[model samples]
Target: MPLYYYYFGVLNATLLFRTARWRPPLLSRHAARGCGHAPSYGKMAARALVQYVVLRGDLRREPLSWPLGALVAQACHAALAVTHAHYQHPDTAAYLDQGGSMRTVVLEAPDESALTTLAETLQQNSIDHKMWIEQPENIATCIVLRPYPKEEVHHHLKKFKLLK
Candidate 1:
């Protein structure tokens, strides 16, 4: 026998699915609703993982006119570093398993101070991340949080805007 609880809105849908006690029932209902049958239970882990990258916007102006690609490289470095550091963790493994579906949200920070402040906040909250410091020149470029279920970290990032 299975239990069913119905609630409207996206948050309710997530709550209904994420409760460990009710996960399988949600999966069955998901397929019944034509979400397409998942080949394995792992495929039904609908947590929606994400890695957030915050790059310093000052790099784009005045004294330093780094091209867009160069700034992007900073984000890439941080993301790869953090992912590698946490490769053995469950969420990280699930994110990598997502392959083509992996999601990364890049946002712009005002300057070094802002990036540093945000890093401190994450540290205080026990959120692990990699803050990439450009070598040779040795400048803090960007920070990347290891893959996490969006809801776990979205509130900390709500203030940032997507990088344009």
Candidate 2:
């Protein structure tokens, strides 16, 4: 009667009540297999897949001042393009399978140079990503990485901050 088992039982009971379907036993699959301990909630959360989108902050600032809607469109374009390009990739497939639970982290790069440098670094590392260069104007506005395990790409992105 560990605390996690109690919480797990409560969660299973709630699921059963809501879905009206048979649920598995209170012991987790790992525990049932004789593992000494089940993964902690924090560990489970760390396993989640995520996508990272870096948009240029300068686009919305003075000098090159693009409209807010336009910046949003750039992010959308980059995200969709990368997802479509890597749709067949295993990580992308698994991430998409999460449906409503899918996670995306949107960060801000100071300007074109930072965005391009990041893209180049990713390229050198063989990381999969797409850099969206807006047509007609041919400006590189944003970059999106295919869904990846956070541990695999977080170091490269730690310098950037979440878009405000």
Candidate 3:
């Protein structure tokens, strides 16, 4: 290809390498840096998922819910986690408990059939939910139910773009 394009590629690669090696400024002990973007509902939701996944280990094995005053980002995280469709595996039932006071649930499944079963079960429980698809280890889905009101999400989403 053109020499200019080759040099540009090399420069871009070098910058990425340097940034990856650089340390970010630490926030207060109580505050953590987010994904480096404005607090949109989608971004918040993404954060919640990462936190939930990291904290809970397995979404399928846990039933999660948040109080009304919980951070929207946390809600979004749980929402994104369940809707992702990976938490539907039958193995997930071990972590589920009927008496949990969750306003929402995150279901993850590894396959379409399992996801379908999960959706049906949630519907049967009279629980409100949403669906998300994720590729973790394998193609899977996570369904997040009883999400924060759509109004909250719409408000945040309006300020953000889904595509860069």
Candidate 4:
């Protein structure tokens, strides 16, 4: 009933019909004149149908990591700062996520360069994971780690008489 069925029937006839074999075989010749041999009409039609069906409803779009340059920049900045702090600490190492956020990699590096290297390592890993980086500040500073912890943040605020 489908158009494909008709193509398949014609293909079967060309391949198996007794009279067609005896005839000039123009259809077969046309199908085989080039490309070494022509593929079966049925197969070609089926392939085309499959391609059409598979592509249906599919809309190509840019991948998320296309804007990674922004993330890279943020990661670099945070990494630099974290590395600075981490350099002061003899124990804990610092790292930036591929998404360009900082986190403490405890029991890790002993200095700034090591922490920066760790951040770089995380950036590379983020590239491998195909994630886009975003700033936590966009949501709120609560999410961003200032150069100091809450207590330190408060201590600095006290200088401005902002902290009670």
Candidate 5:
């Protein structure tokens, strides 16, 4: 003969039984509360993981007529500089940890004035960024914001459109 006790609600009402060759199975209280069911972010990570790259659209317009590739290179430069500058940041690490799937939104500003104005707005809001100045030319051609959760900075960038 064996004695067995059971509880309902895992912790409340109780019942006792005595039966030969019968036993209560072991169970953990914490396990029943879904302790091991936290959401897993493997492969497809969470959203809002992006960096914003803004380049002057005028480079490809008017008499300047810079090559399309040249403008792309400027954006790349800013992206590299900003990422390097903030490599130790948690958001930056998460962004890069995405490996080949790293995300960046390339936006276009109409001209240097537009770029400068956006820079001012970002500065006013205390957002960290790098305004890339090309050497010899000494021009503010592109800007890159440190990797951030999109929701944190999207409003400031929403007015701009994709570079291409």
Candidate 6:
């Protein structure tokens, strides 16, 4: 009988009964026109927007040996910076509007040189991204691209493996 349970129960009942006639405001236009069920993964994947984060792997392995938390923070910093820079873009808006469905792929660049090269490629291709340079020390730590249709940017990133 907690307040949240009662409210959730009522909301669930409302949705269950009215699903065919009412759609949640957050659903995409295509979804709103369909049966209440979620879209199939294949269909979703075809148009899915994704943000890509590339972190420098060398920092975790050797000479630099940055702490795990610091690397994570670098990725976070780049992601937020680029998102803010592109907040007005349609893809970015839609990506943010997905709420819990937002997707991000974290990949690894072997070292600072690889990261810099990737950033240069992204820039040459007119892909917008933020490369985070850790302050004071001026070390380039990570790069995060704004949300884009997966197909549009995948080729530029296919060579990089996911950060394990």
Show pairs that collide, candidate 4: none
Q: Pick by lDDT: which candidate is best?
A: 6
Summarize candidate 4's per-residue lDDT along 11-85 as a digit string, tens digits.
433334345343223334533544233334444333221000001010112332324344334444544454454
Note each model's CA RMSD in angstroms: 12.0, 9.3, 17.8, 25.6, 16.8, 6.1
Which candidate number would show the highest TM-score if scored against the true structure? 6
| Worst window of 10 by summed lDDT in candidate 2 | 20-29
Model 4 Cα displacement at 107 (Å)? 18
User: Candidate 3 vs candidate 6: which has greater TM-score?
Assistant: 6
Question: TM-score of model 1 relative to the true fold?
Answer: 0.72
Between candidates 4 and 5, which one is better according to lDDT? Answer: 5
lDDT of each: 0.78, 0.80, 0.35, 0.28, 0.75, 0.83
Candidate 2 accuracy as lDDT: 0.80
Model 5: pairs clashing at backbone N, Cα or C within 3 Å: none
Error of 5 at 66 (Å): 0.6
- Per-residue lDDT of model 5, residues 1-164, tens digit only: 32333356342212332334322221132234444422223523655577899999988887889898888888888888888888766676556655456678999998999999999999999998999998899989998999888889999999899988
Model 2 lDDT at residue 56? 93
For model 3, the run of ten residues with the poorest summed lDDT: 90-99
Checking candidate 1 for backbone clashes, the offending pairs are none
Using all chains and alpha carbons, the TM-scores for the candidates as numbered come to: 0.72, 0.73, 0.24, 0.20, 0.71, 0.75
Give the C-alpha miss distance for residue 45 in model 5, angstroms. 3.2
**Cα TM-score of candidate 2:** 0.73
Compared with the true structure, what per-residue lDDT tens digits does model 3 show for residues 30-133?
12433232233344343332112111113323243323333234346555555444333221221121112223322223334655565576577554455443
> lDDT score, residue 110, model 5?
88
Give candidate 1 misplaced runs (Cα > 4 Å).
1-45
Ranking by lDDT: 6, 2, 1, 5, 3, 4
